[model samples]
Target: MWHLSRHCSGKHHFHAIALVTIHEPWGADRVGTSMSSHIEFRKLAAELDGPAFLPGEPGYDAECATYNLLTPLRPAIAVGAATVGDVRAAVRFAGDHKLAVAVRGGGHMQPYTAEGAVLITLDRLADVTVDGGRRTARVTGGARWEEVIDAASKEGLAPMSGSSTTVGAIGYVLGGGQSPIFGRPYGYASDHVTSFDIVTADGVLRTVSAGAEPELFAALRGGKGNFGVVTAMEIELFPVTSVLAGGIYFPGSATGEVLRAWRDWAATLPEQATTSVAVQRLPPVEELPEPLRGAHVVHLRYAYLGPAETGLELLAPMRAAAPALIDTIAEAPYKTAAVLHNDPVGAMPYQDRSLGLAGLPDKALDKLAELLGPGTPIPLTSVELRALGGALDRPPATPDSVPSRGLPFQFFGFAVGGDDLDELGRRLDRLFTAMRPWADPKHRRMLNFLSPEEALDPQSLREVYGAENYDRLLAVKRRFDPNTMFRMNHTLR
Candidate 1:
């Protein structure tokens, strides 16, 4: 019954969900605005152990904003929950009050979903634990990478986390995490998790691991966040912290030559080196160091975990590919390896899309260079290819884990923002059209990078999971979430 509206040109009618107006946990929550919606939310708030935010609250604006900066989002009640009981209460509150429910993990959600629902803010649920003897991290779903990595590194352990330590653990894992140098060691990040504390459609707190709920584990992994709300997860970690991390950026003029050269070198690289070639625009900020500042360049980010000499030797061919405009690659701590990507520290409006290809043929490389290099209207900011099939190819010790296909999950995409979002999306689509022939028909879109509206398509989900696994996920959903009470994403089916 709670209504959510923002002051951005007033609220438009949402044709999102065909919800039912009943106060039951088995059906969809009502979507139409009601006169006593606030009062109903107040009543539900009284029955919960969590703090709820109504419209006009002091912290309302900050709480509802996601990683996206383009769209203004506002939710009715932002529930700050601390315990499993609190999450259960919030779920019941949404069900009884007939309000849509949206879950927030690190507030990095790209597609805004705070329009008409009761937002479940997971920031307060932060928790990170490390078991040094076993080299594992038992982190809460709401926990950020800083907490997970900082704590794990203290015990000489590290997990397959993302470049930006600010990203959420659960969100990154479920969407398939691409580590700093994943291809050489761990193929993908999702294969590291051992267990998940899941809240399914029926609002039940279920513990899913390798032996139990195997199908669910597989589905939840890389299937995207469709089946349930993950509360906590136990993921494997590695020993040591120091790594040879950094990048070498080539000038815009050598974009084609550098990309082709780096591609060939990476193909012959050993498992100890993790590297990707990125096409980036140097920002007009003094924060950027010399050489790389204020210039568009093709950059090669690298992480060699084995040893420094071996690392230098492995990249010799790339060093000879093209004279570097700015080379920062060197031996550095793995904890700071994130600096290689240098993702923005603050939140900005961003739109992401990804394509997984088998190999970058000569023609595909030409088209990529055409769209990414320079003078392209879309400004395809970054083109990253993280090699797959390292230790990540090995089967995990848990059930319902996201499977790591023993093949290169080549990722090529860009982050677009500013006032020309519509133009950027259209331009990227056209560019992708030119490159689609190079894409493997069996390739699946990475949920973390796909457009959210198109992300939930069943066909896309099936593509990501393959038909057999997708059918298996449907059967698992039937058993744990038959009513589809947890209808928050595109991966759910």
Candidate 2:
């Protein structure tokens, strides 16, 4: 049985207390070996400052929970890491037992089932510290964007946080985080990272930075979780405390006109303005406001880091394209920026796909309208086209391997349901296939947007990173994880 509790008087703020009397040994072919392995695992458990549970133990399922219910985690053992030492111990235990290491933070992306890997839960290690003088935030393990935003906002600053505040800050940055609001102006969240405290496959914790381990740093910036489990990260923050941003929902009947207007107007906007438009089929849920509940609409998300008047003036063209079902765009504090995208919270089954577009000409816009507009019998929940460029196209002062930099737009679509995952997958495939003509010729994509379905295709993965970056990533993989212990994610192998 497991007993969890929170306390403030300790090196770690939280802890998971486990008291197991029964020994449920795994892979017990013989009595002697089973007993020995059980004792060894007990020793490992004793070494951790947090709780450790076997496959059938209580809290294991909760500890291994994932945001995407379609891909559930069934690990050999689950460790609730309360401290950096607990993370180190978990990694070392996995290495000693010849088990792959899997990490869960905010539980957003789970590319694999992790059938027998050692899963480390980082929920206990969440802590954020803001440095007003240096204009940086030190985000500890499992710290969500909400926590970072809350902390940084107190200092009159903000991090390059993504649309969803529930997303793990470290994992997002590791995947080359593309912020809906800050992306075009400030670049990716990974570009602003100063350093990472990660435990590699060898169970050694290393502080990786551009100046320290340059190659490893570059690889980790956009490499996802292929290298190791990150314990903490220090990222640069901006001084702006407020922005003019929010969503405008237009009836789906106006999808074509709104799409064209947004496409044309987005092209004329300055770097201070960032925008995206989505065709959404909202569910009839009580949580949503009445107008948007069960509504088929075109959502135009806008964010401008300039004066409210200028922002309003710039957004006038698209706003006038069609009558709005609901318009929530207004000047607001940066802490409330998540309202712009209003990404769904809580766990749900979903299949998603993303594509990079070199350009979105009139023909492409028409095709999008046909695919996602109300006229068609589309089953997908939402399909979005985010404008990319400006600062996103420029290289950071400290170079990193964040792909999708020069792409004009990113196309993303998802269908939410568990009743028929195969059908949902087919729908996504059909949508992308229809838009193939405008797809980025080189197949360069936003690393963060690469879905589990796309990650499964080895050739597509190679093209997403490009030949040179993929080759370098492979070399780094061989150097750091020679035995391929970190194979749970979109592996380089």
Candidate 3:
């Protein structure tokens, strides 16, 4: 029997799992500390084909860097797994030594690094293969969406990937990715996963799909990385060559007007048309276009998989709703759709939170504007509400646990750090609290959006998967990971 923690913070009750004690890598110069009493390090290193970096070893710093700059990762040892066998060896070694383990795909997830833990960096596992005839793309665990898009485009097909091409393909899909435009028509990126090649806690490789290991397959779809390390996955591709997509920016003065109009207009949009309204405070950076740099504006991101003329007609109402300062919306190859949201590419300190809503009533919009509009007390960078409906409301034949399926809109807010982490935290707390009244309880956090700090909270996991799904996830977790060895990202335990 699993005894739950009586003091589980935020209502997270799980089996009592032993915490791995932190110790310097045995091979590194111990200074005063000694590895004289432990197992030989070279013997373990020799078992794996990939390079293993001990603390203070060369390449350790570079390999451990996470995409979220705010996370400070200090793993006792890091391994760059090149083959399936290498991964197996690493997990087995960790289990034998009672060391905790964590896996990275492009190092973009909430950094799960801790002392005495084995960090498996999958940067070398990146291999994208597109089968044009089958209209499917086989993406490795570490492959980024840009590579997936570039490869799929060559075959005249496109993937239902996230807004930023830099995000890891497998990680995004597994965590329930919400693509800006394609979501309305095809549902989420996870819906298109053909299969997954995962390495479980017991060091066995398993191929999961709808027909095989169906329960585990459903859990993997939106279960995050709780069950195992996903080495590779095959995703279904769509027949899309070009799209009418980009952003339309209105001057800061028009933020209120544009948002109100956008909310009302987006409610009536067809499934083919997907849009999001954002209030942005762009930094004065040279990388950004002149119109967006150092500007506070209302930007509407649009993506429509239709003829250019028809897309324009559909968007006509929005164009006339407010006087625009800049309009980049145009017909372009689907590969260029990345520009619609224009997410930042480089690493920076950021605090992010999201909520779901059945509908954005006038009261909610008024509250949102008060909280995130220009000259607000909060130092927020952007607040966006993406419209969700149409195909997104329909579940796949073989269901997965993606959240917010029937919700009409999703509200996301971000506070980028500017030398003050404490202030950023405080501001974000106030921002979310002020807008809680309109937040739907049924809406939960998507795993991809979870920060390292947030992922550690079991209550957050319960919120992400919900009560019924959370209980079911626990059952699946016990089946594959009886000891909870894979308790790294958004852990079930």
| Best by the TM-score measure | 2
What ranking of all candidate models by lDDT puts the best one first? Answer: 2, 3, 1
lDDT: worst 10-residue window of model 2: 12-21
Every candidate's lDDT: 0.68, 0.81, 0.76
Off by over 4 Å in 3: 1-40, 110-112
TM-score of 3: 0.91
Cand. 3 Cα-lDDT: 0.76
Off by over 4 Å in 2: 1-36, 107-111
Candidate topping lDDT: 2
Evaluation by lDDT, superior candidate among 2 and 3: 2
Question: 313-392, model 1: which lDDT tens digit per residue?
Answer: 88888888888886778876666775577766565554556676767888988887887777766566566766655664
- Tell me how far the alpha carbon of residue 258 in candidate 3 is from the true structure, in angstroms, after superposition: 1.1
Candidate number that wins on lDDT, 1 or 2: 2
Model 3 superposed RMSD (Cα): 7.5
Residue pairs that clash (backbone atoms under 3 angstroms), model 1: 69-349, 209-399, 210-398, 210-399, 217-400, 217-401, 218-400, 218-401, 221-402, 456-490
Alpha-carbon shift of residue 200 in model 3 (angstroms): 0.3
Q: How far does residue 286 in candidate 3 sit from its true spot (Å)? A: 1.6
